[model samples]
Target: MNEKAWENFIVKNQVSKDIPEDIVMSWKRSVRAGIRPDLKKAPQILNHQDIQHIASTNLLHRIFSQLSGEMEKYFNKYDISLSLADEEGRIIASFVEGQLKETLQEIRFYEGGHWNESKSGTNAIGTALAADKAIVIKGAQHFCENWHPFSCAGVPIRHPLNQKIAGILDLTSVNELFPDNALSLTAVFVQSMESLWHAELLQDTEKIRQEFKTYLKNIKEDDVLAVDSSGGIVDKFTKGSNQDIEHLIPLTLRNLKKGENKEEIPLENGTDVKGRIIPVKRNGRMVGGITHIRKERSLGAFRQEQNSDSPFSRLIGQNDNWKQVIESAKRVAARNMPVLVTGESGTGKELIAQAIHEASDRKNHTFLAVNCASLNHELAASELFGYAPGAFTGALKTGKKGWFEAADGGTLFLDEISEMPSSIQAMLLRVLQEKQVIRIGEHTPRSVNVRIIAASNRDLKEWIQAGKFRSDLYFRLNVGRLHLPSLHERKTDIPVLANHILKNIDNQFQIDACAMEVLQNYSWPGNVRELQNAIEYAVLYARDRVIKEHDLPGDLLNNENQRYSMGLHLVSNEKNRQSKETKISEEDQLLKTIEACRFNMTQASKELGISRSTLYRRLKKYELQV
Candidate 1:
């Protein structure tokens, strides 16, 4: 069936004979579950501990170790991702390649994401689990609109002993179609894993039995039990047939599955007991666990200490380039020297400077920020350096301490340093070299111990070449340097930054997946500041506290729509002569724009009113190099 048929089924509950019976049933089940058609991503229902438990399972660890190389080959050959999810549909492991890894992560297809039908709607993984068989879900067959651009196949892996479903082996393709052998390949992998699991269980059960005997001799006055991988009791040692100890078995299994090695279990008799579980492993695969139970000690109550905030805690970024910048800042923060931070406006230069100050020895002292660009040309010296009594007109009779002296034994941040007057730059250089500030119209110089952090959006090297800034001052300030990446250059951080912004506004507010996609695709010209404003605007207009696509600013939507239109136009005008002439002019314009932006794709795309992808395509068509 096509999109229209799918729409009819969803809107009117009318199923066509052309649609597969399994898909129809899945659709009905999804509707009954109250799954929204526009759901953007799978819910993340598992935490780090839960994922660790699944990953450490004997059977899964073996499967992953054995098949990782083969999975990588398949991913390289087919450009698809291979994922393993537990019976509950929580993804435990995924094998993906390069940029596709980030793309899939955006849709919550990574480890710890829940893909059960109740959570993620109708898809290969969920539908295959529901049917207890292999299935392929193609575009339009998926119940959720956000999943309509991809195709997926899933095969349920069954436990060898019980023939019951244990997990799922899935292959997903973003090209809207998979090879005919995709499902067969998934089944083959599952069959191999099950076969390996059967052999390992038979061999490990005997090893566990041998290991359990040694543990029994060491325990005295305490109950010890040996449990199989599935928590089935294999043997027990106790002073008597203690019924209360059996009650502890359930609690022990629960804690083990949560990846906890030790836990306090309170008995029905109001007696507290402590249980310690030690795993019995053969060849890196867990065979069973040895549980030791003893009376709890009457120790004082203890609480974990809260961690103190780091100076970089306020900085939010996960991109590799951004992380490197932060790391460099951290290294320089311990040294006593002048630092120069350079980046585009709104790229958090001042934040970095502040972080450096907070991380340094002078953090407890004053931290003063002066905007050199805003300083008056005539009064710049007087503002930066103190003036003696009756030094000039309107001067205070008692004299005044300038910013340099006021910020002594602390850090002083100078923003837009390139905009400082030429004479003031000379004075700043003198202060840095002499470690003293000479007051205006004063013979004596006052010693001031201060660390300087300078920031500028313009290229100071270019300004120096233009005779607008002093080379000596630039060199002194550049003792330590950091350049922050723009928001567009670090799009991977958009989701994190947006979520942080939302939490700051209201804990209940959230952004829809579709809205997040829009935010990620937009070339943010104003960097983090622009993103903050956009999120604030979205929250104000959001419905039901969820920021959907319609709630975004009109400019954001218009830009996306314009890019979509241009993409279509490019496809349709592939052969027209008039379009060829237009293309020639467009190619020249793109080249000029790239040169003007210094080969930075983000800025070039923003200036040209096109998406980065569109710009890349145009560059390829014209055979132009960056």
Candidate 2:
């Protein structure tokens, strides 16, 4: 605390002489870069008064309310007070020993004060956010010399999946401690705060993702679209299918000169996707495009995209493989042969199966689904083959109809077919070959006209080789094969699926570019099902009507793969087309208009402010309502 000691400390580090004037300037620049830029109204405030008001807002109130009991226990152990800040760097929560209460309140610190490098030079809270990590600013390290008298350390709090910061946890005091111990203590405290934040994010992940799915449809991004290298229209946003925004216009994307300007690629679809396709280098050699998408959006502009409908309807997006699956489904449906569908969990194998059934000649007939995995050996056999009256202990008097019989003149979908016992497999193989089945305890076999669609997440052939699945049955059902691409394989479809689901919940789910990219970049190991579940989650947690990148599951957003940083490029053209025109924001709205006139494109066109070409374009673009 003395001048002599301060000089000694400076000298010991060699910071007084080794640092050049330019390096000093660069350090100042780095400090500026480390500060997180504050937004207007929400991120920006008129002054400390406004920040204090926000600190007292309901959002802060609830957060503090939840932490009160737990925080008390934590503070007692560390002998440290707790402080809370809103996203705007306003102090919302502060606690110390009862004796120091007056001093705490008397402090000039309130809310809405800037801690970002751009505003305050270099400090803990602002720098942590800009750096997106934990940091310490002890005494002299403080950005503003006035803050030097005290030592402060803060860490960024986020969901384990890395969703968003609820706030920050900081330790500040005049107490002196060994530097080595100090870092560890700060880490411990910050981690505890992060633990609390992560728990909340995980609990809310699904809710928020779902809410975001639907809510993003209403987001108003100046220029947002899915684009590839050089910025061609991979996809675009539209209000109504009938609106002629320009069909599949492919625009070339070029890089902007390096420096301050960000490159925005324009799409023929009349939208913008932001990012640059710079050389991605591993060890000096070029890899590919290093693209980026922004997650931040204006709150007011966000609510405009909210819509309400079933979450399932929003599953439209295109990938070559997905399209191949669709075309294969049509072919499989047209044939009378048994079809086997395979994919990892959540790839929508069942949906593809249903599509095949719907596209078949027997579209009008009933389609029954039975999960082979859910039935026991005896029950399973009886369930598939049917049981005659008095056939077993619990047999119905009239004899229950087998799935084959119940599904006569229609289609029978057996899910998880790999789980079927050898006995059941034999029975199923017979039905496939002869088209006949006899109820349990029945003497005669009755002919049935039913199509069979078998699906599983496992590789049936591999199982058969392992002796778990019957080779004969696998061969019978494998007459036609279809593989559903994993979510990662069809990363391009994320925005489409998100939009599709969101459109069902609410017609206004306009996806912001950053949010869309986050969805696209996620590894999606749980596949489509996981993506769907996450969307369902986001829906519940989203605050505004739009889905922000922050609403995504922490795991998906973490960029653990880091592949996204390079994989994402300008989809600016597609994004621009999304906001160009057309009014109906929800998929159901489009479907409703279609059904009102019996799916007649002409009638729907007039109602939807689009042309027949646009209608057809949409049908293809969104893979609309079957």
The numbered model that scores best in TM-score is 1
TM-score of 2: 0.41
- Per-residue alpha-carbon lDDT of model 2 for 1-626, expressed as tens digits? 33333344334523445333332342355444553212111233346545433433323334554555555554542345455655545555565555334333333333444444455544566556656666666665543445555566766655344356656665666545314454466566557656664554343433333433333354344323333222333343444322332322233233321211234445456676443222221111111222223334543333332212122223356788887877677777789888899989888877877777756766545578888889888688788888876898977644667788767767789999988888878888888889899888888998888889899998776787899988888888888999888888888788777776776666655556556655765678888778777777777777667776667677765562354223212112221222334454445455655666566665555455433544565667667754
Overall local distance difference test of candidate 2? 0.57
Q: How close to the true structure is residue 258 of candidate 1, measured as C-alpha lDDT?
A: 59
RMSD (Cα, Å) for all candidates, in order, is 33.8, 27.9
Q: In order, what lDDT does every prediction score?
A: 0.79, 0.57
TM-score quality measure for candidate 1: 0.44
Per-residue alpha-carbon lDDT of candidate 1 for residues 172-268, written as tens digits (9 for 90 to 100)? 8775447778899888888888888888777777777776665554444457777767656777777533534555566556655655554555556
* Model 1 RMSD vs true structure: 33.8
Q: What is the TM-score of each candidate against the true structure?
A: 0.44, 0.41
